[model samples]
Target: MKILIPFYSTYGHVYKMAEAIAEGVEKVEGVNAELRRIEEAIPEETLKEIGAFEAQKDFAHIPECNLDDLKEADGIIIGTPTRFGNIAGQVQNFLDTTGSLWMEGALIGKVGSVFVSTASQHGGQETTIRNLHTTLLHHGMIIVGLPYSFAGQGTIDEISGGSPYGATTIAGSDGSRMPSENELEGARFQGEHVAKIVAKMTV
Candidate 1:
């Protein structure tokens, strides 16, 4: 099984979440996870929006990936840094371009999951996950999320990365907190669970 993990990261917090989720997917035998980034179109006012000094930084530019990677993926897990309780504009923009894929039902029956990073405890992680789910549902994809059996289920009040909705990470207000061991373990378990479901459905 091949799973595509595609996302956009602003502060690199979401990138870490994607790596942990990919680690989980790779744990399953015969499953492979590919990480890809979405490229942003150059804006006419890029320097004005980002400042000339900041535009020179590598992080200032978005990377590119082939859309065929998404088409060939048996499963897809998307991650993004939360923006006002929704996916980042770049990620949303990429999904919006999948209208042709949706028309062809290219993503139908594939397993899909969402992961997110938030700057605050109440920064709308769940809302962002739900919004991601809405896009997957439109493509007739199967959605998977962490179950209550995971070790972190209902255990941590500080950060509940495990959700029935999907996996997530809370980066804290200062962006210092990384995903806990339990959260990483739970994310891996979620990936394995989704892969198994996809295999069974394909059979």
Candidate 2:
């Protein structure tokens, strides 16, 4: 089975979580995951101001995700940094172009999940995830989240960002903070769980 992880990141925090999710997907034998990014709509000047956009080269080679990638995946995971309590504009623009796919129900029955990052603790992480789920539901995709079986989802000891809605990270203002170990683990759990679901559905 194949899982597609399509994410949008400005300061690279979300990108790191995407890689963790892919790592989890690999833990499930026979399931492969690919990481792709939605095209950046941010102006060149604006990206330069974020700084990390140019410094992060780990995923520079990955192609921009398209509608076909969405159609072909047995499961899909989306990640994005929050923008005013919602998903990034670049990610939203990519989905906006998938009207034809929605018309044909190309994603129906496929599993979908979301992850997000924010600048502050209450920086709308939950609302951002919920907003994304609303779109996934419109595509008739089965929504999957990190259940409590992944202990990281319920952690309250160290400061972390994750819940039943999905995995999340706290990216400090000015893009200083990165995802904590627990948050990354949560992302991986979500990936493995989604792949497991796809495996069973296919069986």
Candidate 3:
């Protein structure tokens, strides 16, 4: 079984979470995890002006995902930084190209999950993930989330992000904060949980 993790990150927080999720997916026997990048929509000059060019280079070597990648995978986990309470434009652009898949029902019966990063504790993580679910539903996917069973999500010991909707991390306003260990653990759990579901369904 194959699980494809496609993500977009402006400052690497989402990328870190993606790596952790991939780790979890790989824990399942007979499952393979692949990390992919959503194509950037921002112009090179604009990215440089916004100081994100250099940070993005860290994961630039990861292969860019295409629609075929979505069709071929048994499960998919998406990661993106929240953009104004929703998925980033790059993620939107990538998902928008899946109309053909929807027409052919290519993704129907697949497992779909998402994770996100936001600039603050309440920066719309749940809403962002919920919106991503809306898209997956349109593709007829089986939605999976970071269920409450992940005990770390219920703790108030540290300011962290993890909801029943999905795993998330809070980036500082200036984008300095990375995903904490707790948030990454939630992401891993979600990934493993989704992979297990796909394994059963595919088998």
Against the true structure, what is each candidate's TM-score? 0.85, 0.96, 0.98
| Backbone Cα, N, C clashes tallied per candidate | 0, 0, 0
lDDT (Cα atoms) of all candidates against the true structure: 0.77, 0.90, 0.94
Encode model 3's per-residue lDDT on 1-203: one tens digit a residue.
99999999988999999999999999899999999999988899999999999999999999999999999999999999999999999999999889999999999999999999999999999999999999999999999998899999999999999999989999999998898999999989988998899889988
For candidate 3, list the clashing residue pairs, or say none. none
Where does candidate 2 have its weakest 10-residue lDDT segment? Answer: 50-59
- RMSD for each of the candidates: 3.5, 1.1, 0.8
Best candidate, lDDT: 3
Q: Give the Cα-based TM-score of candidate 3 against the true structure.
A: 0.98
Give the winner by lDDT: 1 or 2.
Answer: 2
Ranking by lDDT: 3, 2, 1
Candidate 3 segments whose C-alpha is farther than 4 A from its true place: none
lDDT of 2 by residue, 119-195 (tens): 98889999999999999999999999889898876777888899889999998887788899999999989989998
- Give the C-alpha miss distance for residue 12 in model 3, angstroms: 0.6
On a 0 to 100 scale, what is the lDDT of residue 132 in model 1? 89
Better of 1 and 3 by TM-score: 3
